[model samples]
Target: MKKLILVLVLVMGVFFSGNAQKVPTSEEIAKKNIEEMDKRLKLTPTQRSVIYNYAFDMAKEQLLLYKKQVAGTAKEEDETRIYRLQNEMNKNIKLVLKPDQIDEFNKLNEERLSGIDPGKKKKKKKKGEEEEKVVGIEGLKSTGNN
Candidate 1:
């Protein structure tokens, strides 16, 4: 969910930019995340709790990392750590959610991450478990050998 992180960053950026009278607390952030996820995923009570815990933990880490960055003390490792937190959360979420739910989640998730700059070329990034798409243009697969 790059879109998830991008939305988070944009929201936080806006809040920190003087629009918000006071910074939101960790619990507030977690509650917002849970509400948004609940609306999108239609999570059951159990799924909601599990996701709430996971999202809360990630939010905490993100908040701490953000504070460090604002203080001009965060390292590159901190950035990587946030990425890991997001990836880890997604993995755990998949373990709890049904396959259909995962698909729906992914589809809705993409809607938020769309609209990249028109001038830039697209780059594909795959995680460990994701497979690369194969297009047959009279390639070996076209011969039908499993």
Candidate 2:
């Protein structure tokens, strides 16, 4: 019993410690996002600076909106905010990036907005038969008698 208790405590400590690590700050998030874009786009120094500021501002705004639970409470407003941010970022990007870079950036944004990763391929299902669709909670209710 003593050995079991000791092992359980140690296991719990490791689990909690992993979850207790500090969250990255907005600056950290912005730096990482900018670094990724710079790598893919080969950004000029001027473009890098502009994108860094835009990324930093966006990270801070997203953090604030998340903290406010705006997504849960106001779905339309949250979406509108995100769309505006995207537009502003794109406007800034167009001014600094080359024409070819703009096309690449647009493609990257399209992939992100669509939630599709180009590197991973999902297998296609058979086309011969359609799957059954459940209607409402009726399908989930317990049918067994007490």
Candidate 3:
């Protein structure tokens, strides 16, 4: 029947659309970031592993705090949580990096933040607009031009 066919199409569309919009886990994001940093900083495998573990733990903690902040938490509470997270992150960096590397990391973070276009707000794109894959070291190598 026509009604049955219509319902089937609608259900299929919904299923496929949901599958297309999958968000990466915090661990995935942290690993991707660490991998990129390894490439950029020329970090050794041991350094990369340590940094990745630290970042992953930090991201997990921060993500929970962020969720709380989004759900009607006070600004002061959010700020305190973020400050604590920063301290923890700093401590982790100290454990894994030399003082000079820590300084370099701070500067790199500042530069990256500054380079973002302030006027352009990020918005969810329409389904058809292909998502830009986050480029890691392999991606750069594949492109053959940095």
Candidate 4:
């Protein structure tokens, strides 16, 4: 009976822990972003400071948007706004980077963008199937006549 209770408690703990996610604070997000940039672009102290400021502001904006979305109060334009926010951050970061670092930064951006799908799925056409054209009322009338 003790073993059964222990197993049950362990399973319950795992189930609850698996569903909980902790959101990062703005500072944490900014620190992470600059760390990645430092690793990839070899940023100097001045560049890191400027980029961290940009990243922190972007992260705060993103967190606000995320909260609104979770509360079901987000506008349709909020989706586009997130992209605009990131673009602004990228532009500011580019200004602080050297010419060579800018090339590496662009490549990183491309790699990140490539992973996202545009939320569109094209319908697949079957083999030997011709595309269908819409017929107007006049054309339908002509086809109905023997």
lDDT of 3 by residue, 36-69 (tens): 6665566767888888887787666555644454
The 10-residue segment of model 2 with minimum total lDDT is 1-10
Residues 36-63, model 2: lDDT tens digits: 7887789999889999999888777655
Cα-based lDDT for every prediction:
0.72, 0.63, 0.57, 0.66
Report model 1's TM-score to 2 decimal places: 0.70
When summed lDDT is taken over every stretch of 10 residues in candidate 1, the lowest stretch is 137-146
Per-candidate TM-scores read 0.70, 0.60, 0.53, 0.63
Candidate 1 off by > 4 Å: 1-7, 115-146
Better of 2 and 3 by lDDT: 2
Give the TM-score comparing model 3 with the true structure, all chains together.
Answer: 0.53
lDDT, candidate 2, at 23: 43
Winner on TM-score between 3 and 4 is 4
CA deviation > 4 Å runs, candidate 3: 1-21, 98-100, 115-146
How do these models rank on TM-score, best leading?
1, 4, 2, 3
Question: How does candidate 4 score on lDDT?
Answer: 0.66
What is the Å distance of residue 73 in model 4 from its true position?
0.6
Off by over 4 Å in 2: 1-21, 70-79, 117-146
Cα TM-score of candidate 2: 0.60
User: For residues 1-146, what per-residue lDDT tens digits would candidate 1 score against the true structure?
Assistant: 65567566665765676654677777888898688778878999999999889978987887887678678998988877777788888889989999889997676556545523223455555666553455665343222222
